[model samples]
Target: MSSLKPIRKAVFPVAGLGTRFLPATKAIPKELLPIVDRPLIQYAVDEAREAGIEQMIFVTGRGKTAIVEHFDVAYELESTMAARGKEMSALGPTRATPGDIITVRQQVPMGLGHAIWCARAIVGDEPFAIFLPDELLIARNGGAGCMKQMVEAYGEVGGNIISVLEVPRDEVSNYGVIDPGERNGALTEVRGLVEKPPVEKAPSNRILSGRYILQPEVMRTLERQGKGAGGEIQLTDAMATMIGNQPFHALEFDGRRFDCGSKLGFVEATLTLALERADMGADVRAMAERLLNA
Candidate 1:
C-alpha cells in the first residue's frame, strides 16, 4: 500500500435536516442555502476540487436529492445556454468534468459519523477529506482553502489531520475541543478530544472546525460505536478514540471561519463576502458606515 495513499476522495456529511433554518430549509436542503451567490455546499465542493480530490462522496439524506442535482449538469439549462452563446456565464465551475460527483444516501438521520459511513464503499480503503458545508472558511489567500493545505501536510505525516480554530473559552462548549501535547508550528500533536465540553472543563480552546483529512481507520471505529452525545453517532467521539493509536494532529487554520448554520453567522458570512466583491464593495462599505452613523 502507498504510504501517502492518494486522498482522491472527499466525504461530505450533509444529511442534517437543518431544523434551525426551518421553513427556508423545509423545502430546500440547508446545504443549498446561498452564502452570497453560490450555495453553502458549492463552497465545500470547490474546496475539495482545489485540494485535488478527484471524487466527491456526499452522504445525504431524504429531501437532499437537490444537493446531488446541484452538482450534476443541468442538461436543459446547458443546452439553452449554449444555444444563446451564454455558456460561459450560465455554466460555472459547478458543471465540473463528468464522473467527478457522486452521492450516497444516509437513509437514517444518524449523526455525522453515520452519514460518513454511508460513503464507505465509495471512499474504499483510502485516506479521504471531509468537509462540512456549514463551516464556511474565508481565507485571505483563496477562500479558506484549508483542506488543500492539510493534504500537503498529510503527505508528510500520514495520519488524520483536521483544520482547527481557537474559539473563546465561553464558546468552547460549542465545538469539539482538542487536547494538545507537542507543538510543531502550525501543526499541533493531538493527545485527545472532548466534544462540546463545558467552558471550564474544555481541554483546549482549539476546536475542530469543518475541514478534515481523516484516515480510513476512523470508519472502523464509528462502525463499532453506539450513539454518543445527543443520541447521535458523533464523528468527534470516533476521532477521539484514534488519538493515540494514529498520528492525529490539528492544523491551526489561518483564515476566518463562518459558522453559516446559525442565523448570525450566516448573515456575517454574507455581508463579509459581499464586501469583498469589487462591484459591491463601495455600496456595502457605505451601507456599513451609514448603519454605524445611525
Candidate 2:
C-alpha cells in the first residue's frame, strides 16, 4: 500500500468524431453534449477530481478545441454575469486550476488503446486513471463516485483496478466480460477478459463500466498491440495480456451507469439527471408523469 505510487493524472479520450449523434455532434463534440445542464465530459472530470486526480490529459482530435476552451477562464462571460448579478456556481465545474488541463491530439481515429497511448509521454512511469466521457456514472445514495470508489480500493490492493458492473446474463455479449478468479465482496480477481464474446461462450455477466485505474506498464503492451476485435487496437486486448503478470481486479462499485453515446442512453441520462436536480426535479417529474399519462 505504502509502496504504491498515488494516482495524480487522469486521461480523457475525447477525440472521437462522435458519429453517433450525427448533425448535433457535427458541430459539437459528443462530450460537450449536455446530459441535463453540465456537458458529458464535465461529469467524468468531476468524478476524477473527487478521486484526487491532479492533472487532466485530454486526447482530442480536430474540432475538439471547445472541450479545451470549456475549462479556460471566460473573462468576458464572467464579467457580464457579474454585472448582471447572475450566479456563477453553474460554471464552477468547468473551471480548472492553472496547468491542471493538458491536451494532446490523436490525429488518427484508431481505438481506445491508441488514444490512451497518445498520453504516454505525459503519463510516463505513473499509475493513472482513464475516464470515458460517454459513460455517465452516478454514485447515488451518498456513495462515492465510481472512480473514487475504485481509487480507494486501489490503495488497498495496489495494481490495475477496473470498475465493473453486473449486467444481465443476456447482455453479457454486449460488453467485455471478465473471467472470474476470486471474489471478496465488491472486488473480484480477473483471470481473463473476453471482449464482446458470443452469448453462448460468455464467461460472466460482469462487464467493464468505462472507468479504469491502470499502471503505466499497460501502455507498453498497447504500444505493440495490434488490431483485435474491431480492426483497431482494443484496450481490453492490452489489459487482458497483463492479467497474470499484474494484480488485476474488478470492482463492482455502487453506481448506476448510463451510456450517453447512444440515443436511448442520452435521453435516459438526461431525464435521470434532470429528475435528480433540486431546482428542476419536481417540474421534470410532473412533466414525465403527464407525458406517460397522455
Question: lDDT of each model, Cα atoms only?
Answer: 0.87, 0.93
lDDT digits (tens) for residues 1-294 of candidate 2? 889999999999999998989999998999999888789999999999999999999999999999999999999999999999999998888889999999999999999999999999999999999999998899979789999999999999989999888888998877888999889889999999999999889888899989999999989999888998879888999999999898999999798999888999999999988998899999999999999999
Candidate 2 regions exceeding 4 Å error are: none
Considering only N, C-alpha and C atoms within 3 Å, which residue pairs clash in candidate 1? Answer: 139-144
Q: Count the backbone clashes (under 3 Å) in each candidate.
A: 1, 0
Model 1 Cα lDDT, one tens digit per residue, 1-294: 255788899999888899999999999999999987889988888888888999988888888889878877888988877899784663477776777888888888988889988888888788899999999986675544788878878888878999999887889988888999899988999999888888989988999998998888888988898998789898999999998888998998878899999999999999989999898988999999999999
Best by lDDT: 2
The top-ranked prediction according to TM-score is 2
The list of candidate 1 runs beyond 4 A from truth reads 291-294
**TM-score on alpha carbons, each prediction:** 0.95, 0.98
